[model samples]
Target: MPFPPKANGLFYNSLPPESIYNATPTALEQPFTPKMTVCEERQSLRKRYQFPEEPVDRYVAALSEMAPNCAFGPLENEMVRDQPIEGISSEGIRERLLSIPDFTLEKPLTASQQMEIAKKDAALFSIPDLTAAVQSTESTSFSSFRGTGDLLRPTPPCFRCGRASHLASCSNCHAKHARCRKRDKLGHFAQVCGSVKPSSQHEVVHSVSAVCFTDIRRYHIKTQC
Candidate 1:
């Protein structure tokens, strides 16, 4: 006789996307081991339930109360925290949650609470677990490369500079200032104004000017020596 249609659950309606079975290689050239059973089990579990994303902080507290003798250390708390149950089964969840204590905030078992002298057990334990390495690999491979593409691409010219590059690095322009003049403007002193007329024009004369005849060779160096 065939099994009833409802033998499994809602996920059984359609044939699974991939063959549940697959071949595996053995150390020897033996025939491949069938993987259909394993694949189907994973698929069924994936379809049946979802795990909670929130930190199990409250659950942790409850567990501590319930399992005083069970000694879950900081590392254990972290191990539990880092685990992702996104598709865990309800039974699995029950197993996990029931493992914790059954304490709630309002009823802190007066006598038990009194005796428990609630010393804050710091939840700080650093076990260099593989999570960091896994996260680093994921970020560098998936996220960091995508992020870097934008940062390294050349940006449009700055609006302030109106040039094809960084405004701050533009040597062709200067910042607006109270005492500064624009490059094209002659609002400031003449470039030659600081020098005195030579004591004699002869000092200023060039060989090209035969008509110039002042005799003295020098005068005060200029406006401000």
Candidate 2:
């Protein structure tokens, strides 16, 4: 006896009988309705959609590809209009989108309009403000030049007595020197003083004389009174 006719496999027993095959078309055999297909496509596009870091035109193009047949209803249309404003990586571009004069909730901007504004805003953001840069550079250069000039400038001599390194009030000549006879002022020697009034009738003069006697017998003297 051949082992009591081998038992049917568990998988074979679990499968439906042959009658179920002709009961009705399986889900795979049923042709999907257009609405069902569109719904599935929308769900898939939503899941796969990503806001790229590319230019606004490319971003708009990507959105267009999401619903090529324009099958999205009013709500989805609103989403398509507003997504870039919310999802844009550039704060500047987002602000530009938000600031569109005619882009109210009731009257949303079209893709072409959004693309145009975004392109303009991106261009403006990319350009450097040469006037501001020039002003900043000039300010920095002036500050640096002023600092160096202060460092390199020569220290003036003391005005009172022609001394170096200190102002007249702070110099050693301030107290140590006698009053100038010419100016009748303190803190300076008469010979080295400045800013004194000149006399019209007679001028002050200083003289020095030296005499040496080598041979007394051959010497002659002269005098003026």
Candidate 3:
């Protein structure tokens, strides 16, 4: 398989390393880290990257306990005044979010339910079911059909075996298999109930019939008819 496209990080990381081991520190080398007042740094950082909504009372209280000399800008003062952070509780939001169902997880379905879904999909795709079609219609004769509007059509020979009458339908030739005496795939007899010898020249015709039946079944499957 071809490699997938990688982001810029891959190219940057693929370069050869320059320095290996650390050398003795020179006079120009920087000190480990100069002593710095965190109070001043925090003040400057707060001024530069301040939240638009701040709880003024709580911040003032916190600052009074630490550093009171820090000056806040007008925007910071306004933000602190307009928003009240005293009553904000993350726990409430968490509880509310937990109440909803997560649809991403797989749902359990029984075998029968899955089968029903498959039948529905097959109907949508025009898959044929000969036995069902035959049984569903009120007609006593085989030629008289029913349920012809949509989502159903005539089944190939294979599907007829699946009907309640046949029990799981023949896979070889939809309804036209050797088992089907009406179609006569074996020439002398239907593959389903044929009594003729398999060595006869008619066997070729039967084989071809079987193949045609299978092809027809496949075609019917394509349309879900």
Candidate 4:
């Protein structure tokens, strides 16, 4: 049946284009306020404490990531006051809070006791080991590039060509056209030089030649006759 004509012709029902619930007994009988789930409660809380889209305070962003972790920090007692969010009961929050690790400078025995006893003996509970830890508490070591002896320093780039090479120069640089020392000119090297005399120094030949054929012209005339 429609609403009274005097009131309106419009069907003022909800989602999916219908008032299917109007005739159903189950809908009318059910509780209007349903109990929220744990996730729903958490989401409600997140919306309530939503980080401003463009937050001016840097702490806001940091706090969002570490919100659950805040339970273990000093800030838990000061800045973050717990509010009653449904499904996050006092007992639940306390259990979560207890599980979070609190960093304190107390004796290491408490943490050691929580670990498997076999492993604890190696690092924490033994008097000797504990003493060693205490002694080395102030010791510090730094990470760095390995010592100069440990690494072979890369060779500086060749000046002739701006590239790295091992044997004083690169192959490209070595193959370049070098001036011929023999001819004092470029394009061809000294080994292939066309110079009439070799550029290298030579000893002066001082020994006299003993040639016995001084009548070469007379011998030629007798032969012709």
| TM-score leader | 2
Output the number of the lDDT-best candidate: 2
Number of colliding residue pairs in each model: 6, 0, 18, 0
Q: Each candidate: what lDDT? A: 0.35, 0.53, 0.38, 0.37
Compared with the true structure, what per-residue lDDT tens digits does model 4 show for residues 1-225? 866965443333322344566544444444465866656644543444423232212323333454454344555332322321212223433344345465221212233233324443555556886666654642311111123212333434333323345322345565135776766764445654543222211211111111112233344344345
- Residue-level lDDT of model 2, residues 111-199, one tens digit each, is 44566576778777666787568667766665565555456545455555556566556735553467878779776667666542222
Where model 1 places Cα greater than 4 Å from the true spot, the runs are: 1-133, 168-225
lDDT of 3 by residue, 1-225 (tens): 643467445533444464322322321243455644766744543443213343323434443333323344444443332222222223332233234354111111122234445556766757467656744552333122112211232232222332323322234434433345576343222433333333433455466667655655565454444
Ten-residue stretch with the least lDDT total in model 4 = 201-210
Instruction: TM-score for candidate 3, please give it.
Output: 0.14
TM-scores for every predicted model: 0.17, 0.36, 0.14, 0.14
Whole-model alpha-carbon lDDT for candidate 1: 0.35
Candidate 3's displacement at residue 125, Å, is 14
Clashes of 1: 6
Residue-level lDDT of model 1, residues 49-136, one tens digit each, is 3335322344334333433233344444433332223423234443444344653322222322322233223222333466577557
Quick one: ranking by lDDT, best first? 2, 3, 4, 1
| Candidate 2 backbone clash number | 0
